[model samples]
Target: MSPQARRDQLIALGLAMVGERPLEQVSIDAIAEEAGVSRALLFHYFDSKQDFHVAIARAQAEAMLECTAPEESLGDPLRILTASMSAFVDFVTDNRSAYMALIRGAASADPAMREVFDHTRSVMAGRVLDHAPALEIEPTPVVEMTVHGWIAFVEQTTISWLTDPLITRDELLAVISSALPALASAVGAVLPTAP
Candidate 1:
């Protein structure tokens, strides 16, 4: 296989293994064997096992962002927000293991891994701020802080839902959607009166 192809293959294997457990729990030998390559060859692609796991974590983070991004074609802010939240819920449900590993795994405790995770959170917050205009909310400090707080709530709620799932997915989505107006109120943003 070509060098790039081989590298990608190894990374793919790493991601798969990570999906099964936390990055720290996955064995390098298992990943190498799963990829049908020698352990040394896997090391050749990554400077160390930590690097390999970091790559996987980064990939997972990127996937989450892509999955949760709002569809630009939706013109209404509320509709766009709802669609994005639905997509986010679907992504979390579909990739439960990966979601946990990336968001709450041992790797998240590492500085490098945590950086990737933090960036994802920042991006999510940025999206909310970006949509502020459409939502008729001014992006003031209070609004920004509220957005950050809401993102944390979303993360924790998602983790709980993934772990227990007592609530239906639609119910979880509704809970998230219902929070926006309150968040706007907390930020003192006067939303247009709902019809």
Candidate 2:
């Protein structure tokens, strides 16, 4: 493989392993063997195992962002929010172990992993802020803080839902979809009806 292809191959191998186990437990030796390369060759692509895991975490972050992005083609803000939340829940459910690892890794002391985590949260929060006007959510400082808080709330709630999914998927979706709009209502903005 070319140099970039080799690097991407190693990262893909690591990301697959991440889906099965926690990030810290993703064995570099196992990945190298799976890639048909030496551990030293793997190291050529990454400074260390943590660095490789960081790359995996970055990929995971990007995947979540891509999957959870609102379908602006849906037009109505409420409908867009519902589609985004549904997509987010489905992505997490499909990648449960890996998503948990990403959450745990973000909570770790690793700065690089934390940066990836923070950026993901920022983009997710930004989406809500970007659609604030349509949602009738005032994009004030307090609204910005509320949006970030709601993102954090959804993350923790989804993690809990993964642990014990007593609630039906649609119920979970309803709660997440309606939450920010309710918060906007609390702040004097009228919540738009979902189409």
Candidate 3:
């Protein structure tokens, strides 16, 4: 297999095993055995466990992007946001383990893992900018900060929902919907008056 393809396979294998375990419990050996490759080969593909984690981060970001795709082009901004949140909740529910690992590891001390964590949020920020242009006020840094905060909120809430399935998708959707006005207000507050 090509290097990229092999890397994807290893990432998928890692994601599969991570399905609900904490980040610390997961090991390179487990991922290597799961991928049917030796530890050396795994290391060859990725410089370290942290590097392999960057692969997983990109994969998770890709998955999130996929989930957002369907609702991204909707005519109504509110509907688009609602659909995205519902999709987000569903993805987290379906990939609880992987989601947990991705979130936790990205927040950890490893620099490589942290980069993925930051990059993944940045990818999501671009999407938010597209969806909520009002947030573009106050220059790029402010916009990015606001977008990152929104991403963090989404990630935190989704994880909370996963901890208790009793929180139905509709309930989460309602909460997300309720936030739209506040998000709009904040975005609008920062934006300058149109000429």
lDDT of 1 at 60: 83
- What lDDT score goes with residue 141 in model 1? 72
User: 171 in model 1: Cα distance from truth in Å?
Assistant: 1.0
lDDT per residue (tens digit) for residues 1-195 in model 3: 999899888888877666657555668999888778899999998888877776776687678678866464577766776777778887877888777777886658877777767777777667666766543343345555666777787788778777765677788778766664576567557664422
> In model 2, where is the ten-residue run with the lowest total lDDT?
186-195
Per-residue lDDT of 1-195 in model 2, one digit per residue for the tens? 899999988888888887888878899999989998899998888999889988998888899999988898999989999999999999999888778877887688999889988889889989999999886556877788888889988989888998899899999999988988878777664434322
lDDT of 1 by residue, 86-136 (tens): 988888877777778777633455788788788888899899899898777
The 10-residue segment of model 1 with minimum total lDDT is 186-195
Q: Which pairs of residues collide in model 1?
A: none
Ranking by lDDT: 2, 1, 3
Local distance difference test, each candidate: 0.81, 0.86, 0.72
TM-score rank order:
2, 1, 3
Top lDDT hit: 2
Q: How far out, in Å, is residue 5 in model 1? A: 2.1
Choose the strongest candidate by TM-score. Answer: 2
Runs with alpha carbons beyond 4 Å of true place in candidate 3:
70-73, 133-144, 186-195
Task: Quote the lDDT for 89 in model 3.
Answer: 80
In model 2, which runs have C-alpha deviations exceeding 4 angstroms? 189-195
| C-alpha RMSD by candidate, in order | 3.8, 3.9, 3.4
